[model samples]
Target: MDHIVIGTAGHVDHGKTTLIKVMTGIETDTTVEEKTRGLSINLGFAYMDLPSGKRAGIVDVPGHEKFIKNMMAGLSGIHLILLVIDAGEGVMPQTKEHIDILQMLGIKKYIIVLTKVNTVDEELVELVVEDIQEQLEGTLLEEAPIYKVDSLSGTGINELISKIDEESQKIERSNSLVSPRMHIDRVFSVKGFGTIVTGTLIEGTLHVNDELIIFPKELRTKIRNIQVHEKNVNEASAGMRVALNLANVHVNDLSRGDTLASSGSVQKTWMIDVKAALLPHAENPINLWDRLRLYIGTREVLCRAVPIGVERLEPGEEAFLQLRLEEEIAAKKGDKYILRSYSPMHVIGGGVILDTLPTKHRRFNEHTIETLKTREKGSTSELIADFMNRKEDLLTSMEETASYLGMPQTEVIEYMGEMVKKNQLIKVHQLYMSSLKYEKLKKDITAILDRYHKSFRLRTGITKEELRSRVASNVKSKDFDKLLQLLADEKVIKNHETISLSEFTVTYNKYQLKDKEDIEQKLKKAGFTPPSELELIGDNKERKELIDSLTGKTIVRLDSETVMFKDYYEEAVQKVINFIKQNGKMTLAEFRDMTGSSRKYSMIILECLDKNKITKRVENFRLLY
Candidate 1:
């Protein structure tokens, strides 16, 4: 865990800023516009040393309705919040709106403060406190302890600070294990420094000199320096307010919505899949293709909500949605977001991101909805299993799985070890094929071999490359090889130079047996020079197929224009061996005279011998291999 951040939220004139000024002695509202209006216009930052000896960072957000956008940005990474309310007026409109935003953002820890108690009598203060407590019911702050205070006199401020310190000590965040990411809420240039950006370190740790990239722009940069609470630091972790001096970028090129993260950690995308819910108090239901403004991690983009498995979403109902955006934003799975009406610009609903990148989904698709539901609520194991099962035909790599599931590669790898143990996944080298897919592939192999054998009974088997192209083309070559070996070991299939069913064998049918004898007799009669396959079969397609099946098995096709019976081919081989041994070598002309054949036939036989390595050709003569 790193530093704990605290934020202020309430309506205007709630004394939220004054309470902070009394505690930290640093006025957050420094701008002339803010001073002149007597209201915080932009986000302000201050830090205070807690009684527990830790410096807690504070964000003072503008309470005015017009600055709700800034308020939402300030609230983005804080672990706890101080929901201040004046004792004079309790539970105002903006107060309720802030509470709604806080709840929608899924913040859990809150400390309700009832400020300016001196302006009213004790009875009225008690009445306001009761009203505030009643409004807090069924909200996140229901159990939160409220403190009565007067920021002007500094009364009851010490107790509030002590409570904040107590709560901050209980915070536990994963700052060390994950990659660092920060959304830039402020971008400016100092006198000597280059572009500097400030935001809360949402996760992981950032170090000086660490190379990073600004997302949506994809401009690479290095961290020149790091600062926390006006003090230079070598490193900063999650939950702390951080300012980074970046190299190789200009202030004008940066903006408030840009994200700074470890390079390759995030990809900019317009479409995102999420489990979204419309607020119960929303003015109207959200229909498909209704353009809405999306806010996540201080970045806002316009998008259209295409509800999955439904045409429109009623208030308070949760469903899977594919948001099609007008522009791109970089986000990760599980990040919370808020959606505002395009024209009115009020918070209508919010959700947690399920997939940073996803293809456009069809409306009312059961498979899409089911898969998204698993992503929304399934465990790590369930998520992994569901993903592999859904993409059963693909060879999913660990890196690809981790990116889609929004998990660390090491974490996904660890879970994969367990998945293989449980027999849920079939791991082949660096890839994973689902156990279900393996079974289906095994079945397909047997079925394909069966069909091939029934169609051509006198052939050996299908080639390995042909089988793989039909069954596992998307699988890696090495992975498919290993799968063949596994299938062979399991007795599901036979793996050789060519793959086949374990029980498949070449056998001739009755008609093919008759054709085989007839063909052999004809070849024997022809002796040294047999008719070509085309001449023998003529137009008999079945006989032609039978002869083709006998190739490399029973009868040998000497050339495109010739064929030889197995015995005659062997007799020719012996004749070559004897002739070569007797005469050391024999020219094609001499072999023609010995076989009593023409030059063309003699050349074909000698060429076949040369190909079979029974004889080697030297110029125009043949010699024993």
Candidate 2:
């Protein structure tokens, strides 16, 4: 069955809650203060059965300007809005505010309800309708049906119900039957039921015995029972006013603005990107870096509003804004938000959440502005994919990515897992590296190696850590190692201990052979006290040519500190082995005595031999193995 949420919006005493009570026979306002004051101060929810056997949830929001925050909480996830106007008062201040807020929130469908018809004459009602018709010009309600109703006398109430029923039949059925979410606008305890929280189910299905997590608090509990429209239901789904009888929670632990979701599905995010607007009657113009109260899906948080593409956003203007919140919030892509000024609070404007978790955006940059604009125009999936593609580093996990994208982690993970199964992307741990990235990494490493050989010929290759640090520092340490291992597995690169290269051995062309011979002759003639690679290649192409030719060859060994010629190294090793054979163990001075070389050279060659598994070096002696 198709389920639709219809919410009422207008000024206080406009009969929003009373109209709902009369239509659905369910009083939404359960608060003592609301009933005593004869005004709703929080969100009140009720549901009615349509003529077509469909069900529609009704959210009766507090219409007083002081409780506008409550109205914002009620408006989220609503498919249809009922903008209630008092026929006797014509158009009031909050009536206009509510209308502007609904427009900014992107409510496309609504039916305007003119209440208190019994208190006014037909001529006055016509004038009120004319004024409303003029005000709703160019808005969502431009052509919507307007109903005149008096809830007190039961006049036009039945007609309003029939209109809602007709509209409910036209509402499209949702395909999503995943885990359920109910943004709690009301929470209280009943005598028999432990802690019952009520709200319109925004998504998924909830049944008895289902585990749920209540957010910002993150409390986990099972559904002891379920009630929809004051009656017991085996299962509740999206667009139903549900009261969940939580198994193990207290009323104090529960509050308004908390969300009930299937366990381990929703995530918290401190940063988000949105496309917000200023309300028409905002007290002040919003400047760059101004702070505002962000009301989204029953949660109100203080967020720093960074105006994108402009230095200031005037009233009634729309712009992309980045909301840097003080606390983490549970929000999904396509969720509507209502923004109010921080001081002398008033509803300014609200828009959709584009990216749930965004890095701080650059101020007023055209490219960044254009990107955010594109994200604003993109679909939920497209925005998610674009967010992933724009990241310089791999997303650490699908869960994190989904949070970053303001999408349900399950939805993104399912789609991403399918893509991986299709070989479009690769996963290492929770990080996703695109197949294109893997291929690019392969090509880049090969190019780096090829360039390295051209620049310094005396080095065998580069260390894995060095290459990783230089090529992409953002790659996670473990994933970098994993990528190197994957490269080795694919034979894209060869790993010799920590040293890695595209090719295992260096090739010897005629030019390289000549260069190697020249360096060898220079080292041998100098009696193994050869010049450093930099010294030989000092500011001259000839020297560079020589070092490049002998890289990775037996002729020159690039050790930790110094370079040793193959012949010199062999002579030194043979002298050490001979001394060890003659003396069983030779002291360092004795080995120095055998090589007749400098202390540094002898020590370096000894360490090189030790590293090569040919000899063991101790405090004062060497042992041939």
Candidate 3:
């Protein structure tokens, strides 16, 4: 069953709270001050059983001119709204402002309930209804049914409830089953329940014994119990007004704007990306980097609006924006937010979050703007896929990705699994990246190595760490490792504790300028001791530099950090291969006996041949592969 929250909005003392009381026999105004003053000062809650047997939560908001902020908080979580206008007075200042705010908040499904109809004549009530029609002409409620009700007389009270049920039944139920995130609109302590927080569970499920994290303060607590409309339940789903009995958090640590969520799932964010359009009838223009008040889910934050691709957001113009907030907020992508001017507190426009965790962007950045537009422009599933594809490395945290995609992580996990089976992408652990990026990285590394081989023909292969440093400009570490592994899988590169090019080779056409016989005699007498390349060059200055360059390239090493020239390695390889062929496989003792060298020299020569893959070292014996 869908958990729907219904809220009332209209001018001050317009019978919003009174109508709720008549419909549900529960006085929403709980405070003595509210009863004495005969006006609601804060939000009130009431619930009723619909004919469909689904329980709907009623949030009664204050209609006074001074309590619009409180009204915004109450209406933020409502799935369907009741715009209660006084029949006698028709639309007043606060009534129009409340209606404009509801439209700006992106409240699409609403019913116009003309309250206090019994206080006015029937003909006058019809005129008031016509006036409401004009007020809602271009908004979401233009076609909404107008119900006349008098809370004092209880007239049309049943009809209002029926209409709420009828409209709520039409809304499609969301299937998200992730960790719960409830924006706390009311925080107080119940005598035995400890600290209880009440609000709409906007996403996921809440259950007893679930560990939760309250954001901004990030206090950890466990849900001792769950309550829906004063009734205890084992589990609570999204769209329901719930009160969570917290085990550890105190009442003073939490407030109205704070959010309670499952630990490790939701992170507090200080910046968000949005795709917003200024209201065409906005009183003032919104300039780039303008400061504004952002109201999202039940939290109001002061934010700097950095417009994307436009310096000044003219009336009716849409653009991507990065909002730098003064306080941390728990917001997801695609969540609607109302943006208001800081001073006048008038709703300038509203927008949907495109990127929850975003870096600051400069104006007129075409690519970033276009990308945000795609997320704002596409359907929910399409946007999710696009966001995952852009991440490139599937290694990004699932929680972060969910926040970036503006959906519950559980929903993303389910859809990601489907996408993976369809060959759209892959998930390793909790991170996701496009399979295309994985393949492209391999091709890029292959191209890089191919270029290095062509340019530096003298070197055997480059070091792996050095390659990573060089490729950092183009590829990230996670992506680089992923590509290297892919290349190794395809046998395009060889991994020897380090990555090496597949076709890399050492050439000595120039190094063999001296006679082979003369070099061998010199190296054999040196006996594990090799002359420096420059010292062996005698008087040729050009030849000295050339041989010196070969010192680091294709050279051989032995124990004690001793180095041998490439010419020596070449000679020793041939000798070792010939010995292996003649004797099938020679032991170290037999090899040393044949070579007429010391144990150290014998071991060094044997190891050099092993390093070059000329022979395999096994205990005391060597074998030719």
Q: Pick the candidate with the highest lDDT.
A: 1
Query: What local lDDT score does residue 213 receive in model 3, on the 0 to 100 scale?
Result: 85
For each candidate, the alpha-carbon lDDT, in order, equals 0.85, 0.76, 0.75
Model 1: lDDT of residue 7? 95
Q: lDDT by residue for model 1 over 353-419, one digit each (tens)?
A: 8876588887877887877888888899888777676663567777667755656678989998999
Report each candidate's C-alpha RMSD, comma-separated, in the order given. 7.7, 10.0, 7.0
lDDT computed for candidate 3: 0.75
lDDT for 146 (candidate 2): 95
State the lDDT at 130 in candidate 3.
82
Decide which is better by lDDT, 2 or 3: 2
Candidate 2's residue-wise lDDT over 1-625, tens digit each? 5668898988889888888888888987897888899999877777777877777888888988998888888876788888888999877889888887888777778898999999988998998899989987987789989999999999988888888888777666542444567788888898976788888787777889988788867888899889876689898777667788898899999888888886545657888878877766677888877888888888889988778777888887887878888988876666788888788787778888877657787877787887787787866545545656656675456755654454556778887887788766777776887777677778888888778767655556776777887777888778888888888888777776444465656556686677667677777775545566676555666656456435445455547335656777777777777777888897766766666766766666677788888888676777886
Please report, as a residue range, the 10-residue window in candidate 2 with the lowest summed lDDT.
545-554
* Every model's TM-score: 0.74, 0.69, 0.75
Tell me which residue pairs clash in candidate 3.
333-406, 394-431, 394-432, 394-433
How many backbone clashes can be found in candidate 1? 0
Off by over 4 Å in 2: 175-179, 262-267, 280-283, 378-382, 389-432, 435-491, 495-500, 506-625
Off by over 4 Å in 1: 389-414, 436-484, 491-625
